[model samples]
Target: MRPFAVNRIPRWISGAVLVLWAFCVVYPVFWSIMGSLKDNQQFFNGKAWALPKFPLLWSNFSYTWETYHFGRYFVNSIVVTVGSMALALLLSATTGYVLARYTFKGSGLLYYFYISSLMIPAILTLVPMFFLFDTLHLTNSLTGLILLYAIGALPFGIFVIMGFFKSLPRELSESATMDGASHYGVFLRIMLPLAMPGLITVSIVNALSFWNEYPLALILMNDPGRYTLPVGLAVMQGEMQYRTEWGPLFAGLFISMVPILLLYAIFQSRINEGLVAGAVK
Candidate 1:
């Protein structure tokens, strides 16, 4: 069709680059799966890239699940992630709608406050949060982490969801109002559903953040029983100095990876759609 399109060398080079990138991304996951089925000796002695031999060790998963209580950690992660996403979405949707649709005194200032807060690093507040959590008896509390995660994600959520709201035509709201829809009805029935792509995008963002969150969870959760998956993985890694259970370690990692990977894979298109709509509108 064109010089660039017909150029075989460039096409070949581009294909090569893509293949290399794909391999780089895929190999680690492949290796991890293979490694999860191997003993320490097989993992070390066999070719690093080789698939596990027959009689694959499924015991690694069982051992990690039972011994490390990864099942507990998995449940904890799900609770925190789902709770945080739900809370954050509700709060962000309401706040973003109000900020985006209604203009009153200090509205701009309020939006800017969130913008500025988003820029502030989370690490800077860790010391303050530690003391505050202790004072409030929130340490090692999953509910407390849910609230914190929701609040921590609020700024970004508001930023994204607010754009979605702003992009929506006011005619939809005005017409719904003319039909005797209350403000809440208009928002719930009309505006919210219209913003589904944005909501999915925001949920995915918060889901990933809360699921993989490390430093905050690590610092706030003191009780081993309360550990989220990331913290649990860290605890597992820490045991490596004393016990190098490579199989179980990879199994733990793979377990932690599954939900987030599946989530992203399913909703990734929505993310792109929402972002593009937000930008365009």
Candidate 2:
């Protein structure tokens, strides 16, 4: 009984720690939602923990959407996220599959090259990339942004997806090939389906980055019409300085959070499963 009670003490401590961490994360989001409902006085006054008052200011969302052209930004973000995610996943899958399965001259070097690229500070290359984009006429365009994002995260996606490929039982691919399946057929029908978890993980990770990216968009999206959500939000925040409109700002933040929350909620289980399985492999 003494040993059992002592073991339970660690469990109790861990549970308490998790609960505290959860509160730390969730309470601020809850407070922000409540803040979105209140006027500046109730929000910034001495009632930070209090619930919103009666007659919720739902107009905050409407006003921001219409007046600030957030609707346009929302659509642009959707387009960029989807387009870049699809392109990145496809490229990563194909590249990772070959690299993980086949050993060719310089394959090791090439993989290391990608892994090493992660070390170079990304910010350092921004100015050079911007000049290259300008030279090639790739600036001020969503397509250019999509291409940049797709290439930018390719190393990470390749690393993750390659692990999935290497971990998979080679018997599956060999069995498919024995039945007259070509390499493409084996990959498309067998290996690709088995690697869904890695695919989802890569897409979700890149989707979040592409959705929230700002610095590149800030430099390239020179035209107001081409602004992504983060850039648009920054612009809005600047304009809001004189007005002090915290309500709409909070509302926009809430809006920005919805897609990411939904994405994780939908694919939460798969993400953990993929990481664990790939790690073991």
Candidate 3:
């Protein structure tokens, strides 16, 4: 009914932008898949985007595993990411709830201080954090990585969860208190259940980041066996520089992404709910 709504040029431009973005994402994935099927020689000779002309080589996965110690790396990544996400969510939820529900001196200033970290580039703190971790003997330890990741993820997680908690009806907590429920009981039983969607969103986002983290792992972790998947892949490429085994490299990259995809698939509904909740408030 509106003139702008009937505008063809705006619709066409928006549609074109989406198409371009889709191509940018899809083409690389398609190329990577194609590359995984081809041997090194075939990858070099064949068209970059075309599928392998020969039967798919299943052995690439085996070679990738044996060569890179990928299994160990994958396990380490999972352990670190899951551990960090759990700690971060637990801490962030408590902090967010306090900020959202309580009115105290400098609460606004406290939140400003917390969320301000998000605006700072991570690279700026990387060196300082590394130095501090070294002083505390946290370098090259999984425990150290987990702690740093959890703390680093806190700002954004708290911001998002705080927003969600603020949007919640305070009457629910009041009602629970009227029934003689303690603060812990109200939070643990009532508020947490309602905040599950936001927590899931934060968890998924943090997990993805911790899983794929490269620069931090590269700086902190020195043991080859303790390397996370991203660092391991980098090491693999470095070790295999002469041969350039695109097949296994692509395979490893594809496999590394599987867990994240699975997490998204499983918690997809909650993730959507959290996104909508954040936007609505």
On lDDT, the leading prediction is 1
Q: State how far residue 136 of model 3 sits from its true place (Å).
A: 2.0
Clashes of each: 0, 0, 0
Worst 10 residues of 3 by lDDT: 272-281
Model 2, range 1-106, lDDT digits (tens) per residue? 4555557789999999999999999999898787778778776784668887889989889887878888888988999999999999988899899999989999
Q: Which window of 10 residues has the lowest lDDT sum in candidate 2?
A: 272-281
Which is the winner by lDDT between candidate 1 and candidate 2? 1
Q: Rate the local accuracy (lDDT) of all candidates.
A: 0.90, 0.86, 0.85
Candidate 1, 1-281: lDDT as tens digits: 54554578888998999999999999999889888998999877988888888799999999999999999999999999999999999999999999999999999999999877866899999999999999999999999999999999888889889988889999999999999999899999999999887888988877888999999999999999999999999999999999889999999999999997898788888766655543442
User: How would the candidate models be sorted by TM-score, starting from the highest?
Assistant: 1, 2, 3
What would the TM-scores of all predictions be?
A: 0.93, 0.88, 0.87
Candidate 3 ranges beyond 4 A from true positions: 1-21, 265-281
Cα-based RMSD of candidate 3: 2.9
Model 3 lDDT on a 0 to 1 scale: 0.85
- Using TM-score, give the best candidate's number: 1
Residue 137 of model 2: what lDDT? 93
After superposition of all CA atoms, the RMSD between model 1 and the true structure is 2.2
lDDT, candidate 3, 1-281, per-residue tens: 65665578888998999999999998887887677778977877867777786688877887787776888888899899999999999889999999999989998898989877777888898889889989999888999999989999888788889987988898999999999999999999999999887888888877878998999999899888779999998887886668678899988887787887798788877666555544453
Per-residue lDDT for 7 in model 1? 79
